[model samples]
Target: MISIATALLCTLVIRSVVSVRGDEECDASAAYSSSGGKICASERGDGYGSHDVIRGEDRMIPIWWNYDIDQLFEDHFDCGQIIYGYDDGHPDDDHDDDYVDGLDDQAVKEQHIKISDPVSETELEKLRYQWEILREKYVREVNIVPIFHEVKLDSATETTGVDGKGGFVDRPRTHGVSAIVVPTRIGDAGPTKGRGVFATAPITKGALVINLDNGSTGLFKVGHSWREFAVSLPREVACNFIEWSWVQTVPPSSVIDEDIRNGLSIFIAFDESNLMNSADWDDVEANVRCGFPPKHEGDDWGPCRFHYHATRDIAAGEELLLNYGDFEEISQQGWVDIGL
Candidate 1:
């Protein structure tokens, strides 16, 4: 039997030789143990033997690192496939199908996969920031303006006539009439006297008069005697009369009246008793006659007054003529002009 001391020395020598050989001859037939016995080659067992030192660099890596690498490859490189065990026969060989199956099996065995909890605060904040950016990029805001038209009557005509009794009249009269009156003078200075009247002649039967606000264009009735025209409010002075007031109301109505002999009759009305009492009829007449006051005040007439009369017999297609004063006065009159 070998002595204990000699056996110990031999063991040390064998260990040194194996270390120097590295892994080159681990499986070679010439490899020997300290006793000069051939080293026995053992097949790697079901991954649980003491003799099984993991074969490659994969074995040297931490389990977590290996798992991360596998996951990355699976998610980004492989087309839904997994690479499994490395081949001993061919170092470069890769096993796709088996690898994926192995990974799945390992995951199941270890219970490593599970649904995570709710999104963290950081993630939610990111989402909100993105939403605000989108809102600012697309949001918008706007103000709208309106349009109007002007109408005029031709003064160059022989139709002017005098009523046998007193006042002046126009010829070619019509049963129903409509007209727009403008101020005779317009400027930055005080009010002026020169006003003009535009008459829509040849009034048609069943014609309807339309009232519109400064913001909108008036719509005309079909087959109406007057040509459809746009009307605009005066630009210079604010006409409080045009402002819609709950106190000043007019019933929707129309009227047909004849000229009083040769004298033209015009009507005006007001809300305040004192204002109407202070107005001058003669002044109103002079303005209408000579085209002085362009726009008439509602107070110009007491309660209600006929400011102008038709000069001639008005036909169905003729538009009635009136001074601007008449228009403002009537607005405040609040009487619905259902033709008498």
Candidate 2:
């Protein structure tokens, strides 16, 4: 489904060159046939120079949630102009300086030194000024997910058991509410085992572990119920959503009231939040609990909202676990269960 505009926008033209045989250049009529049907090839030369055309790969970069197609086009166009149009201003010794001798000296110099029209040095600076803003957004959106790692506690913490016998246990085991806890994983016998979040740093009780804000948690197929949306998608796509998404409850509000009854909204964690493993409700293994941000007087609740806070102090390198409750129940559906 890639369009012609996509191809043009993705390809960058670096330089132009022509292949020559000895002292004779290929005639215009034969040039197209000689270079494998490409008038401007990207291969360099042995006395026959060629264009350095480069095409960007069709890969995805994490972008802001609020960005649209128009904004992306504008930013890409501006960035391309700024990057490709830049020159070091070094003089070419191969060119003749006498060509400009009789011309308006100042006018020619100005023409040579000026940047591309509509994009001036001031505009570049202005774009540069937005670097911090973009960086902040990137940090909040991308880096908000904690690092996923696996750790074996080889160097166990030393402690005296009830009989006063020295024993090795997990180190620095602090027990209390934590202020923050990053979305982490642990190796345990659970439904969603093998995947876990490991803490690279110590997290205090009552600390914010990970905030799966609306921007990061993608609301997939906004339907009244999970079954309704899952049935509409293709088999594989529907299964993926069923496995990864949480049935989030969007309370009745002015912004959205369709889920007024028992129906809940479906959302998938576009980030690493989806990788978190669940713990049983009766177990003490669950250290973090999901919560929504406090609503202000006018603040509206969107279809997706979630954040995990540490229920107790979590030591560095400890694996984080959550009691999924009914949030993860939808994953129970299968090809036969959903009649796919």
**Most accurate candidate by TM-score:** 2
Question: Which candidate number maximizes lDDT?
Answer: 2
* Model 1 per-residue lDDT tens digits across residues 1-340: 1123322221111222231122434445543333333333332211111131222322321111111212212211221221111233332222233434566466653332221001223222322222222122112110111222222343546333223321335443211111222111111111121111223343222232221223122111111100000001111000111111111222222354332211111121111100111013223322221111223444233211222323234353322333334334444332221110
Prediction 2 TM-score vs. true: 0.34
lDDT of each: 0.23, 0.37
Residue 167 of model 1 has an lDDT of 31
* 109 Cα displacement, candidate 1 (Å): 99
lDDT, model 2? 0.37
- With candidate 2 superimposed using the best TM-score fit, by how many Å does residue 305's alpha carbon deviate from the native? 5.0
* lDDT, candidate 2, 1-340, per-residue tens: 1122332332232234443333444556533422122232212211112111212134221121112222222221212222222122321121124543555778765553342222344323322222222223223333323322222333354331111111222332222111223534332323224334577677876577766543344342222223333333332233334455555444444455543222344454434354455666335577766654234656542332356667678887777767776343445332222222
